[model samples]
Target: MYSHWARFAVFVFCLTAPLSIAIAESDTGKNNPANLVGHGGPIKAIAISGDGKTVLTGSFDYSAILWQLDNTTTNKLARRYSEHEGAINTVTFIGQNSRFLSAGDDGGVYLWDRASDNLLMQFKGHQAKVLSLAVSDDGKLAASASWDRTVRLWDLDNLKPLAILKGHKGPVNAVLISGAGQQVYSGSYDGSIIKWSVKTGRQERPLYLHGWGINVMKWLPGKQQILFGTVNGDVQIFDLKADSIAKVLIPHQRPVLALAVSGDGKFLASGGGDGLIRVWNTADWSVVEELNLSFGPVWSMVFSADNKKIYYTGLDDYAVAWKISPRKIGQEVQGKFPRRFQKLQNMSLGERQFARKCSICHTLKAGDQNRAGPSLFKIFGRPAGTLKGYKYSPGLLKSKIVWNEKTIDQLFAIGPQHVTPGSKMPLQKISEKNKRQALIRFLKANTQ
Candidate 1:
């Protein structure tokens, strides 16, 4: 769900250290800052291989890093790849996870085969910095857009220039390869998207999509709906069902740097100048998750094939990954919140805050293992004295206090030490009344 407050946080983040220059046009503007990942360098771009076994990224530092993606990693399993002489803008894993490709500020494209850990080939053809790139599914062709105002096609087999697709008066910002493996979509400053036939190296569909230059178009994994990440921060969903624009998803505060369709195509991931990753549910076009990064505009992103994780990059030359698959589901129940909690939305906020602050010490629901603290899922209305197989302070056992709103508040604010001097609790008083009250009310309402 999109939270106005969360979105506001993203807006502030963009202003401080913009993730991209394209964020000037976000209309819907629903971003979340709570997803922040505290880090120094902001990421410029990120990519995951077809096998979902590896991730690659490039940054302002003129370097790239590869991650193994899961827990199966160690110092030897991960290593930094620094072959580019300038800031790397884009990278992609080649067919069958055999090789990798990168385009950068050097106005050159370099091919790398990790098996040899050596530069396989370098195509120094573009006159300007390459901003975007795409590789066909069969891995036979490569298309790149450059600040030089041109899109160049390269043959992966022999590393030769196939042809240069021109006509955009300004720089070409983004490009994509369609799922059919036959077409190439390029978005340029000319405010149009041009489609090229990959076979004969000819223009297939020209002057289509977006009134202004389209920033990006991502083909969903399972459906024909193509999602476009625009400089305007509006994510457009083109549904084959409607044979047109099915929905326009604008939820970021800045120009979208990248548009990634989940491997299953059930969700859409958008990241860019906003330093936030917004995941929109394909069924409703509503944002379901907002993951925040601490710095840099996300220049690009890619999802693991199983939809289990997400990887993105920022301008700061860093790459990061997040878990997204086997989606975490929270346990929900009825009548667990106060009647006065009239604001269902407030309850959600309160729940989130509670989870953040208290989950470590106590269990609020079933199946959540107790750490150093006790379970509070049903603590209200019951005698607060004792539970089976638990340790209780002698003072608390003697005080015989009941678990109620007032008692809970006093225990938290005044501290268990004051209420029951000999209590075993190791804590201090909670200073804020509102927070204490929210916690007390929440615990009480869920007791039943």
Candidate 2:
């Protein structure tokens, strides 16, 4: 099995100043014109409006941000919505950019008004995390795939559930609605793709099956073909009419996690766990551009309206753009390195342990609340779930456990799930006493 895939900047800018000046001031080092850097955690989902004037990104920080993009100026973070209780997994523009939908680990699919930045409705029914979302061509219906082993169809106009397409035998990982909104397709960890009738929630037929789990899927132009990426790194096209594989693309050595097609259907882009992205010309399926991010796995990607640029999100806290036009195909992407968690020579064992275990989510410094977890600075005597401005789960708040050497040691020894049930902290355990001691020592020394 694939056990290697680990789950994978806050820029403040003056509002009244010129947009270019704001980006120039905040974007020092690796930040550039092609980067949208404002999220507190790794961006998991990205969507661009039809006009390409706006961008939406969902993140592990449990927030979705709206951004303004223009030809004359750099992109600016416009608004942030943090209503979700868990990490956001999918986001898309619905109803012609006037509204949008966001789904997350909390199993809630939120409908929002784009203009007012208000929550219009919360479509809740999924028992587990929602992984992917798709809207119909006419924008009247939407489908959401969830780990609950179901794909829920929604009437976008009525803001209600239309049907629960429940044929998948395993956690549904990807979902797609046909162009005419008559059929829905879902791919699952069970390695089967099932096509369902949208109106009756009945299984139409099994489309295809592979040995590996399907990670992402997309409907190609004309709806006669479908492109999908698998956990085993196979990017293949399935001809719907023939019910057979049309083309096979082996672009990555690791799991293929993302697939995107341009609005005009001229290009296709795929990203994988190897931190590589390949852009293909759909006409001939020829590789036009390839980029080595040298950072982390890409989780989501979308092409700009003009199809000249690709916007993608990875483990980094920002969305990056790659120029895919012929003029800028091979240009090197600069300055995303000296990662905070990267190991250096002669580091202590405790420091290394911190880096491997806690560095990605918890920062050691105060005033650095840009990560998913609250800062651990001065954590020795702090009470659990008491950090200001950091949202804590109700279960954690009710636990009333104080952070001290004993509690901290017990936390890792028992794991967060046992110590604080229902908390947002991911399941982690330090079974080795020496390693736990090292991590605790590192936290004690650095957290001060």
Candidate 3:
């Protein structure tokens, strides 16, 4: 679906750390923390283990981190996996938490063994970015929805593709597997939800036609109902028994990006592009609590097994776990967050140009390899792809282009795709000559 508009680049590097690394824990207590800091870029997807003892977060940094959750003043980060060539979009613990799956912009689905922290398999068939993934209750089957307008069913046990289900007129954004593993439901940007028979590999029936694009979907506890959040900020519940929409709620004026159902089946949390999170009581579908996330849009969310906390991800570099029981309306202080790319009040024209054109993917300091793109420090005289640790694309590694004033200006003048064809650099251009000059001047002044 590519629900978020931002794009991040990638580079592979050797890992030197062991399985567990000690990180400074926030003193915000047990149920909630201000943030879990690890990923160098914005978090995009999150998943919690059934026992609530562990958390897995995927990010635009092209890595997924596993964390040990507890009530102490310190949290132990278990491991980090960085096999993907692009940003991670979805991650889930499957097969009784013994194995896991992660898919992303690279259109590749990765299966990993949790205990060994080793990649077991990689499934590739989708032609575009994979948006969502769902596993059956028994964990024997998995389904993936992609921007290619197709849904693929996989035999999780065999780690092979089982069937390709296609019917959507537009990109498929969300998918769900039935409790018994008999049916798969897929929702698309075309505003239609279709049910497919897993065994027959055919569309059994059309579920519902939402007026707006569906961004996310979750199954209610008993499997008799489905809850979905839309691109137009509407959260609607569909009654499977009645075969119609039963309830509708507008929690945000912008796109509803994330939704999570509590493990205990007591509460449902919905977050949107408006930076608001609304908690609802499942029995009555009434609002129980509201949180204003002053940071930015919510990208993904998950509930702790105990139902007392909701872990969410957004544009911020760190992921946050919010306390749910006390029901306090909390919000981050605006303009005070520590995001690296945030605009300063006294920023000049050249600075603004850098912030807009280069900040999201590139860093300015030496030894700052955490960002998606390589650090730009002392780049004015370097040859392309000559950085110490970053793994550049084959085309970039063989390119004759050097990082000079004329080359840098021309790189963005026509776009990276034109300047370095087949490179990992995203296709972005500064159409205005002055804006290009300002960005180049800013890079020259700061990158040294």
Candidate 4:
């Protein structure tokens, strides 16, 4: 999220000069405005090209957009690829930004040529949503993690399935291909990280285990270590040689949803449901800075090619960029709602409450529409985990509870995690009974 004045500053800068030069000039001060704002829905994934001259973003709008970065002109939207039938969950550049890969709730991976914006090929095998994707160093192979509880490897050259690596007890949330392209690592909702052999498609042994599900993970460059973000708000670094967690950092109060490491391997960034992005120094693992971007949960983040700026997306409809400066600390940026929702004078008190508290992450529309959470339209009579395009937690998928007034009230009474453990929904407890009742009433009225 960004403040009105901050957004205005960026707007003026963009209108006056090329973005690259504007950003370069702003580096002189830590108070400079640094956020890019132009998306229609919550962003799910972000990737930077190898040359650092381009950016790729995937969104719940069911499209991935390509942006070109240059000093001579404003960063322009190069293209918008809308081939996916469902919300895109993952996107990655294949080789030198010439081609890229994307996968979504439709359970298919699509390859695209950047220059032509053409769908080169479609690879389908997973029976469920693809949550994460990774490309091998050689760019010859791609690995995808899926809600099917399996990791599918694809031969990029042939555009065919190479192997299906199994063994995770729960849905795989994150996957990574080794720099040498010999090993594949996957983190799952089962709270285990498993390794697989690239040649045989056989799972090795569990590398690490925690009490909470792994939400995101990244491999440290040129090392046998990994940084993992957990659903319980902890980030741990696991050492391969020691086969144990070497360091644990508690930087978030809610689930850590995203993690990114700078290309130079000097900085590590982590974002969480608390709407905070923390930068850590790789040399000493000390916190360098904390950015308070008042968005909802940050779903994705990536470092700029020069590693001087970081880009992130989340509950908001735009991707935000922040300059990484050692001199800046505890900086705050505010975001404004859309013009349509700015004036709510006619809405009732209960409706206003719902809009303020529940609307950021959940939509009120029908037919399986999903934001950060599933739609609540006609929700009172449906069973949990029945949303077609949503990837529900394993506990919820097996849940037998139906949504009624009593259950809905209890959901807010104790929180969603208490009602359905391991669900992706964050802990949001409405302790006041009247408040919960009012919110539920507003939901019922709107849905009906």
Candidate 5:
């Protein structure tokens, strides 16, 4: 049995921030500022402290930084941990804020004593990247989901492997432990959700299927329901007792990547590759707010302890926090670029078209971090994979094509797959010749 208030406490502690906080005033006269902005690469994971005064963020730069949260002043980075050899995927604060665990692509989990900034212990068992982690309410048991398609249980009290629960056919992406620490739930890219008994290491019968690969999931506090975000961009609520999907939401246009529920069980937030975050009223399941992040796909999101704010990471290096006000529903917040680049805002028709379409995944400025796509700075004459620091697909890396006007036009005319087979770029084909020419013109203008 789960107590709502107690589960709320656990939710606050488990869900997971830093940079010069820029104050972006909304047109509604609301001051909704981006709370933190200092990661060097895309942020992969986020967790807030039990006290709500601190935040932890994991990034593709192979580091996790702890930040002090202050509303009145800009949040400051408190500590930087760089022991991991690969991109960090999941981070969680255990007990209070003093102890924390981070899992990375290196297939290792490291526990740290935050007060002393010391590495307390390291646990390794998974054969592939660990995608998600959950700690029991008592902080005695830990569950980790990995791309190896197994969920490993750890005895946190003894710092040893307890059990390995294997059943999923594809990579396990999400895991959650019951408040009492008796049961564990895991979701996988195979589209199945499996429940396991922590004590017996036995899985329950009758798997719940999502029809699409699950990307992220959350157990509702004080309720027998689980919220799942799927690769098909559907958000499904599955009832544990009824063992079926009670509700299905299609709010996003692309794959859903992150999900978070309010600590008090009043609201639910889901973010997706469509660059939108939708907030729903839990009582009626009606959408109360929709935030357009405009940065690329959102990879992670977490609600503030008070439930009045949401901190999320997207394709950008910086993790952003937005203020939430139920009274001000349907309000919009526009993205703020640096003031020094205001002249770039005077876009021609071609540039405006590119800004509306291509700007979400590609930055025009030089020296900026890569987003979903590589920066387009000086892209006109560069080779496909010549942009340094971006992880290019094998096909693009081995290609001999230079990004001239004709090649750039061909890319959108037939799609990246046709232009360069096996490229990881999403399937987006701009069939209109004029549109492609306009886009190419904008690219040439910006790159020059």
Candidate 6:
């Protein structure tokens, strides 16, 4: 997309400044968050599978990792596509649906069979590192922008060079193929955005958006408007058909380096040298949400299939995934289940103790099924009979114990299973009676 956006000072390695991550779901349909995915290295680029079942991310660590979307704590790494000499700079979903293409400074493009983590094919044509990549709408061709000052089109099926479109006087920085697959647009250091006829390999339009080199450009999905950023600080939106500015926006406090739009095209996000990614409402050009990259300069950003999450890469060592809707400090609320406190709000001493000692695998709800242990919300005022959906120690289940204050005190002293028997609560005790009493009070408050 190319209108005009600006640039700022780049963050070098070892840069660590504190920036908080926050979210607001009221304007959109987002609700309380459920989970988050974390990456091992500074994430450089990210792409989501069409079905939203999987996510693809490229990192400065020289690896492209595919992640299953459903599991949050499950950081199981699947399909480590290796072969590139340098870090993977971009990964995009193309063709039939789950198919992916990854390219990097190594000047290599590798097609991947996502299900098997298999390399379908590799294409080499660029003389230098491929800086950006785009897939044709019909998925028949993949276009690569490179420092070599050339945009090479590769046959998607054959992994062979279909054609080389050369015109940029300097390293090509960005590329986009129209959804109709009839046109290709490339931006370069020469400070111009050139549209090319895909059928004839000829330049169609060349629009200079800024005085300086273009750093990034993206086409708004299903529209004639293109959004772009430059080496200075200007962000502009243009009506591609008319070649006029539709809107000029302040996308970041600094240079905008990366951009991604939500599937519905209602929201757009920009990553910049300030190590921050800002989200905006497209219809009104209002700022919606902003995220700060804690470790590195934000290199890229991507939305998940459900649009419920956005993932970004920084220059740091790992990728960071964020919940589309998160409860912010002072905005936390009690949910349908007890013991589910809103984020960052002050909790009772008892709740703090429970969180520290027992929340690792359990959800504190009355009827919810156990995670690693049984729910205990309704246990205080109820009999200690074996709960359904839980495996109980034999001695405690048949004990038919009553939950009395004295009983709780004793159980906190001796083991609950030893005092009763069928209890499966791990062996844990508070040596201080006052702390034990406080925890019991908190548990009792929620149980009622």
Q: Against the true structure, what is each candidate's TM-score? A: 0.60, 0.84, 0.85, 0.69, 0.68, 0.65
Candidate 2 scores a C-alpha RMSD against the true structure in Å of: 6.9
Off by over 4 Å in 1: 1-14, 17-42, 72-77, 207-209, 239-243, 292-296, 315-317, 324-448
Q: Which ten residues in a row are the worst by lDDT in model 6?
A: 1-10
Per-residue CA lDDT of model 4 for 338-415, tens digit only, reads 312222778776686676566645678665346556778888889988977665667788888899899989988999
Clashes of 2: 0
Candidate 1, TM-score vs. the true structure?
0.60
Which candidate would rank higher by lDDT, 4 or 6? 4
Sorted on TM-score, best first, the list reads: 3, 2, 4, 5, 6, 1
Clashing pairs in 2: none
Candidate 6 lDDT over residue span 65-176, tens digit each: 7776653543445566545545577888887566888888577888887667678888887877777889987788889998788888888866778778888887788888
Supply the global lDDT for candidate 5. Answer: 0.75
lDDT of 3 by residue, 1-448 (tens): 3433222111001001112112212333223344567777788999888888888888887788998887545456789887776788999889578988999888899898988989988899998889899999898898999989999988888888999998898888899988898999998888888999999999999999988888899888988789999877789989988999888875466777789988878888898776777889878878877766544477899988777778887766667767677644433222234345656677887788777667767888776765667899999989998997776778788899989989989998998888888776766788888988888888888888
Candidate number that wins on TM-score, 3 or 6: 3
Tens-place lDDT digits, model 5, residues 59-144: 86667889888866577888878767567899998976668999977789888887799987889888887989999888888899
Winner on TM-score between 4 and 5 is 4
RMSD, every candidate, angstroms: 18.6, 6.9, 7.1, 11.7, 10.6, 16.4
Computed on alpha carbons, the lDDT of every model, listed in order, comes to: 0.62, 0.79, 0.78, 0.76, 0.75, 0.66
Model 4, C-alpha of 231: deviation from truth (Å)? 0.6
Candidate 2 has a TM-score of: 0.84
Position 200, candidate 2: lDDT: 80
Lowest lDDT 10-residue stretch of candidate 3: 8-17
- Tens-digit per-residue lDDT, 1-448, candidate 2: 1121123111100001111200211224235655787777778999888888899999978889999986454788889888787789999998678999999888999999977888989999998889899999888899999988889998888888888887777778899988888999999878899999987889999889999888889888898898999877789999988889999986576677789988789989998776778889888888887776655467889988888888887766788776667445334343344344556577788887787667766788877774667889999889888888877778778988999888988888999989989887767788888888888888888888
